[model samples]
Target: MEIIIGPLILVAQVALNLFWWALVISAILSWLVAFNVINTSNQFVNSVGSFLYSITEPALRPIRRFVPPLGGLDMSFIVLLLIILFVQNVLARLQYSIG
Candidate 1:
């Protein structure tokens, strides 16, 4: 029982770390999308952008609702990235504090 619980906790922590990393990449890609660095109108770009949007949009939507665009620049991506960073730090601390 003790061995199982210890391994499970380690697995959970690793999963959280990977998720935070994914958020970081997603945020960078979102910036690219916003800047028109990779035009989504192109067929290949559109497909990839659509897939990324499906993954990240749910996380971005609430931030989008509360944080409006400023100076024609969307700030939600930054906000989302900051939130993910906060969450990752908190989880890392929790992992240390636990074991």
Candidate 2:
């Protein structure tokens, strides 16, 4: 049981880290799109944008409902990122205890 649980915990940590990076990439891509730094008309850009959106939108949608945008700035992404960070920290502690 301990052997199985240890691998599972490690996998979870890696997944959480990947998710955190996905959120960061999504945010940066959004900024680039907004500023016209990247053209979505290009196939590569469009595909990358779509992929990032699909990956991050599910987690961000719920946060958007409770937290309204301030002025013209959308803070939902930031809020979601913080929440992810908190969860990652908790997971890290759990992993340490288990090991």
Question: Relative to the true structure, how large is the alpha-carbon lDDT of every model?
Answer: 0.73, 0.87
lDDT digits (tens) for residues 1-99 of candidate 2: 878877887788799889889888888888999999998999998998899899889888898899999997779888987887898788778878887
Q: Write the per-residue lDDT of candidate 1 for residues 2-89, one digit (tens) a residue.
A: 5565566677667656656666676677678888787767898777667767777887788989999999777887787677668767
Model 1: which ten-residue window has the lowest total lDDT?
A: 1-10
Instruction: Score every model by TM-score.
Output: 0.66, 0.92
Positional deviation of residue 54's Cα in model 1 after best superposition, in angstroms: 0.7
TM-score of 2: 0.92
Q: Model 2 clash pairs?
A: none
